[model samples]
Target chain A: MTERYVYMDHSATTAVDRSVLEAMLPYFSEEFGNPNSLHIWGRKARKAVNEAREKVAALVGADASEIIFTGGGSEADNLAIKGAAFARRDKGRHVITTAIEHHAVIDAFHWLEDQGFEVTVLPVDERAMVGISDLESAIRPDTILVSMMYANNEVGTFQPVAEAARICNDRGIIFHVDGVQAAGHIPFNVRDMGIDMLTMSAHKMYGPKGVGGLYIRKGVKIQPIVHGGGQERGLRSGTENTAGIVGFGAAADLASMRFTDGSIEEEVRLRDLLIDSVTSSIEDAYLTGHRTERLPFHASFCIGSLEGESMLLRLDAAGIGASSGSACTSGSLEPSYVLLAMGITHELAHGSLRFSLGKDTTREDIVYVAENLKKIVADLRALSPLWKNRG
Target chain B: MYTEKVMELFMNPKNAGRMEDPDGVGEVGNPRCGDIMKIYIKVKDERIVDISFETFGCASAIASSSMVTEMVKGLTLDEALAISNKDVVNALGGLPPQKIHCSLLAEEGIQAAIEDYRAKRKAGVEAKA
Candidate 1:
């Protein structure tokens, strides 16, 4: 079929890079050996896994031994949250995170709550930014860990992770960062940030899906979330995903090499063009994030009472592939919890759409989307009773 | 995905504006759901001869509202009332399952408009002949 759509939802998952895929083809068949097995084939596989570990470590500026491969970002988050909570239950039974955290982190914290941990959810400003002062205030004698994302997945707001880490370091608290959205797209140094634990996903960084890694600061002492043959230093268990790991490492290597590619600046430029064109042409349309300090590639907006689902469909038909919220929570009937937590009204919240640019996204693509979006929005408003009343 | 019917309505909307001076008007929904439809009707000899609409919402809601206005034009009040969401869906060819609610809301907007017209006419009769 003809390319009927231009994908603008890279915040969800990026297309697998051709280079990363080629690196994986060998591992799945030609070099098929269990890393745990004691053979030359197994040794090669183990060697690849270790190389991947080093590449992953280098991507985040951590020691190779600190990289613990997990199923994906969610599982890594579970490991960091639950493992740390249970392991330190005697020292302290409290955990702190933001209200706008991805469900992976939120649900893990919920599980900790079930196990009798005192969980404090920090609030964000209108831009979905959690305050460091609030983090300080939320800290207590029994707070064992502080978890926050390096950047928000939806609105693309950058969080002050280094500051949060600084505070955590001062208080001797474990600081875990959910960098699944921030990794690759933004520059992150685990050591420089003073993070005890961090999580990342492969697909978000142009690698194959279902593979991810965690950065475990040496001596953090987090118990394994799963039990099996001692793999990932016994933190994440089960037979390793060698092919996915290889792809992840290749992607991480590329991300590190190209982190400063002019593309991010270009994507941000296109993002602003789309936002400016869409909002200026459509009445009552408003951008929904910190105007200047948001993710370089993100554009989120609300257009009056127009339902987001319908607009998304119309925009899709018009050849623009965007998102209503985070792809992870797409079909849920609930409005965006991130926006709601940021104090956006429930009504405007439902009308929201998110457009994020990526490596291949171009100015022409953004312009085409913007022009068609204006038409689609205009037509929808013409049929809206609310628009009529306002007139 | 835009249902065939929804897209058709969006691309070629019917009755998508207010009557020059509508004898009846109806408003429904709010901006929160991203759809608010106001329908205006021109009644001649107790029949809707002209209809127009204004909507503010996402494309589907707007297109659906445009479709609703177009579908209701040149029909009697009772006939317009008989127009069901399924009928609108059928007209649009088909809507994505998630967008079935858009057709539902369109149906409600049409019904609400007719009801508003009836109340106005009834009040007019009580006050006069």
Candidate 2:
């Protein structure tokens, strides 16, 4: 018999919604035309692209003109960080970001550092929160940008983006928020939050992959990382991914509709059920992210003496799709930097597992997952020599 | 990724559990690296009569431990000592490059068990004298 499959790795990538796919279908074949073309077909393609821009902009409260579509979330982040930093080169050589930012933002800052830009990687608290006071202290006359993630991908803890943005605004330092993981799951308004620039991806929010957008608040100058035919306001230059952009627009619209319809609250309820069941039933199983201040659909844990890869393998055998921050899973000898940044021991970090739910995730799915996870963890622990010491 | 043989062995290892009052026990690896294997052996007349292992690691580590135990069962102490990591790797068809360390740990675990058994035997003889 085919095993029952349960996907609990939405944070990694979500399945595209049906409506989003439906909206994208016509753009791929019948309505295929270069948006830059001036013909009727081109006008049709350009109209769809512009409508997508509006839908995406409406999702984040940004003006349609300020939205720059890119290939994916990482690209958006790179453009936001490197573009802004390079554009302001003569003004300052300093940048500030949290250590827990995704590798996209972190690596961009690292590249800037290699190019002689001074970068201050502020440490996070035990709950994976960067200190506002530290941000205030890190700012200097030369600090050109402060790029912090709106939410952590691995742990799901929401960061203080508003406060961070305000601090940067006061210092005249450009603020960029990597909102890829937080965009659809949480309610956000870039204008209301005073965000100078923000990055978000479509695939993380039930939209097609290979499509993402960077929101640059009006008058925020940034150099283009990819130079071509001046697409996306010359900030990102390439033929627009017409189908992907349409799908993204549909996904964004759906996300906004769901937000108003109270579907996210249902997700949160099921998420808490999964979290409570696993943490309470299993010995030495502890939640990794913040207890209360976290994404509604995300739950992570580190079970003592159980390697994440082993647990993932067992979970896979049981037909559950999950992700892990364990060193073994990553094929590296080091565990997740996010957990390590949170001051978790390497041993505990090796035991990390993350489960991010989705809109279609039902109570039955959570119950099945919680029940199987208990057995899987216990069985793996039985095979674990380290587990012998836990008792 | 792992071979079907590795997955099969990992799913139902031949001898997995702690042996009560075993003749000797060997433990290797550490929790920091997310792999630890403890092998217990019961020897009779200088031949291995029984063996079991408790391992904490990815699928390859557990498969290596299970394979090594199956290979050494019923063999004399000298023959068991001759089992190499390469032998364990070959016995399991093959392991990934990074997983070669799992076989090495298995080899070291068996050797450590034999050493512990010899030391215990020598101590027992000394006590009688």
Candidate 3:
């Protein structure tokens, strides 16, 4: 048992890929120029920005002109929700979203509610999936926009977005999908899926932080949340994050290889192994998301009565990096809102754990994590009064 | 966001697990709130002879339970009841502001256990009479 450091918290963030970093390096110093400038230096910078946009657009089957680069995923989400809602205010004052949405989308809706917009939050099933009929019923005649996530961040449950999109399309309401967690991991074409707008974050892939893009279908009405020098076609106005955008492009370029080179299949194999090993080896452990429809790289669970933070600490001691949806881990008094929305009890949700695999994850890594997880869970359960009284 | 001392106690809690045929037992906190501490004590001559705990909580809760049990092991019932959550926090080199509630659970657990012991004693005397 040599010391091993296994990183399984890819949903939180990922290490920047070497090629992505290399692509970004020249832009910071040598290729440095403001895309907003009119000089030769500015043209060179603009070319790089355009190329990055093309690559990002290609990843989602969107046109380069349709992709609006933003600061990050949350900013992109805010812009999509608020921008679309404000742009269509004359047409409607109603909006809808799901209960399992990321805080980025949920909080934006909260702000819209404060602005006197009628907002409907639809609940999910036990699998953390929002029903399409619920979405259809929630849409009012005055509904301006419907924002839903492609895949849930915490539980990895893929929403019925394509169906949801068609429903919104028939109603003449705008549909926005938060694809921050699903974009690079799974293959989705905005055009093919009839998706109007999609959000993506570079950090969720192997790109640098502080750079993400939103794909807005041409003619989809969205005003700029940010107003400044009319950059990003007046949708996002500022000097472009040239280097970070370049890195994001490089990462997006690499993401396509995973689909073509059987890498995603490999990842799915490892992910299933990890899920099976953990669920079978531990007692009273239940998988959190859709068993088959989850992301290829995600496996989440809520074990017995021990708190999540305690399990995380024990796992950390064993040199395994993981994440938990426990209230204690978040320094809050309530467990994960996502888990609760799925009808999980507060006591069981307190034990939530997530392990998001990466491109480099291997079979050995899954075995190591599973072995360590079983021991940690057992140890924490031993000291838990609730575990002692469990039915 | 914990001190090294708190992590130490959390990783290797001094008094942990269920006790058999204990003289007194007290459980505090709620499962819904994600913290519950159960304290068990062995009393001899109105003084705690042995103590253990089974806590379902975060690191701080478990550490507080271990710290309180250790602090009251050799103390009389009155002395144990006098110990405050702030004392437990200080003994663990202070907890984060949000985690201070965990220490309170520990204090309440010990007091409740002591009360249970006294009530049982009175009940025994009345039954004998």
Candidate 4:
């Protein structure tokens, strides 16, 4: 029998929306010209690219000219962190960031350290929230930039980005926020947040893959890491991904409209339902992130004595898609660094599971997941010696 | 990435769970490293009469324990001890490179259980004399 499929891994990537796909069709065939060309075809492509820039910028409350499209969220984060660091090299060589940042930001800082730059990785609280005081103290006279994520991908905890931005602004330091996991799901304005630079991905918000953008607030100096066509106002240099850009624009516009119209309320409701059901029904199941200060569509937990890979496999067999932090899933013996940074034990971290909802998620799907997840966890725990020993 | 056989064994492992008043019990691996296998064996007339296992680990570890238990059932003590991790891996089709250690755990579990049984038998003989 064909089981019903329920997708609950939206934080990893979302399926492209029908409207976004429609917006991108013309750019691939009819208007398939490089924006740099002077011909009429080029003009059409360029207009579409420009219009996309406006739509993406509008979602974040930034000017169209300030948007720099890149290959994906990682590229956007690289440009913001490395670009800002190199641009302000004359002022300082020190950077401040949290230990919970994505590898895109963390690895960039590691590379900087190899080049003789100093980095201070601040620790987070148990809920994965970076303290504002720690951010303040990490700032030094030679500190040039601060890069922190808006929300954690694994635990779904929202950070105090606005407070961090304010702290950076007061210190005359460049601040970059990796908003890849937060942009579409949460309501936040870059201008009001006082963010100098922010990175977001299209694929995380019902748009096409391989297209994302960096929002550079006006007057923020950043050097281009990829030099070729002098595109993205010389910040990210490459030929435009016209079709992907159009889809991103459409996705952003739609997401913004939904946010305004309160359609995300349904997602929030479903997320909470899944969270409540799993935690309440499953023994030793513990929520990972902040109880309330989390993404509207994110629900994460660590079920006791059950390996995440086993749980994920059982869930997949039941026609449900989920993600985990188990060593088996990551192809490494260690658990997730984010969970470790939040002071979770190795055993608990190994059992971590994340279920991210999206626009397409339904109440019935949530109910099904809760029921199947309870059974899956129970089955796995039954075969687990550790679970039996605990009793 | 597991083979179909591995997945099958993992879903419904053979000879799983602890045995009451078993001749010997063996536990191997550590929970901190994310895998632990406990094996129980019942011996009669120097031949293995029954064997069972309980494992806490990923799919590969559980399947490895299950496969090893099935391989050693009704075998002599020496024959059971002769079974290697490679035999368990081969029995389950194959295991991923990273999961090779799980098969090793199964081999160690069987050895430990047999060793425990031998030690107990020797102690009983000494006490009788």
Best by lDDT: 3
Winner on lDDT between 1 and 4 is 4
Q: Candidate 3 — which residues are off by over 4 angstroms? A: A389-391
- State the C-alpha lDDT per candidate: 0.82, 0.92, 0.93, 0.91
Each prediction's interface RMSD? Answer: 4.4, 0.9, 0.6, 1.0
TM-score of 3: 0.99
- Among residues 3 or more apart in sequence or in different chains, the pairs in candidate 2 whose N, CA or C atoms overlap within 3 Å are none
Please write out the lDDT profile of model 3 over residues A1-391, one tens digit for every residue: 2398899999999999999999999999999999878999999999999999999999999999999999999999999999999999999899999999999999999999998899999999999999888987887889999999999989999999999988888888999999999999888899888899999999999999999899999999798989999899899998899999999999999997777899999999999999899889998999999998998899999997889998888888888888999999888999999999999999999999999999998888999999999988877888998785433
Instruction: Identify the candidate with maximal DockQ.
Output: 3
Residue A293, candidate 2: C-alpha displacement in angstroms: 1.1
Off by over 4 Å in 1: A1-5, A273-283, A326-334, A388-391, B1-3, B57-75, B83-101
- DockQ for the candidates, in order: 0.46, 0.83, 0.92, 0.79
lDDT of 4 by residue, B1-129 (tens): 799999998888889876889999999988777888899999999998999998878889989998999999999999999999999999899999999999999999999999999999999999999
By summed lDDT, the worst window of 10 consecutive residues in model 4 chain A runs over A382-391
Runs off by more than 4 Å, candidate 4: A389-391
Better of 1 and 2 by TM-score: 2
Clashing residue pairs in candidate 4, if any?
A: none
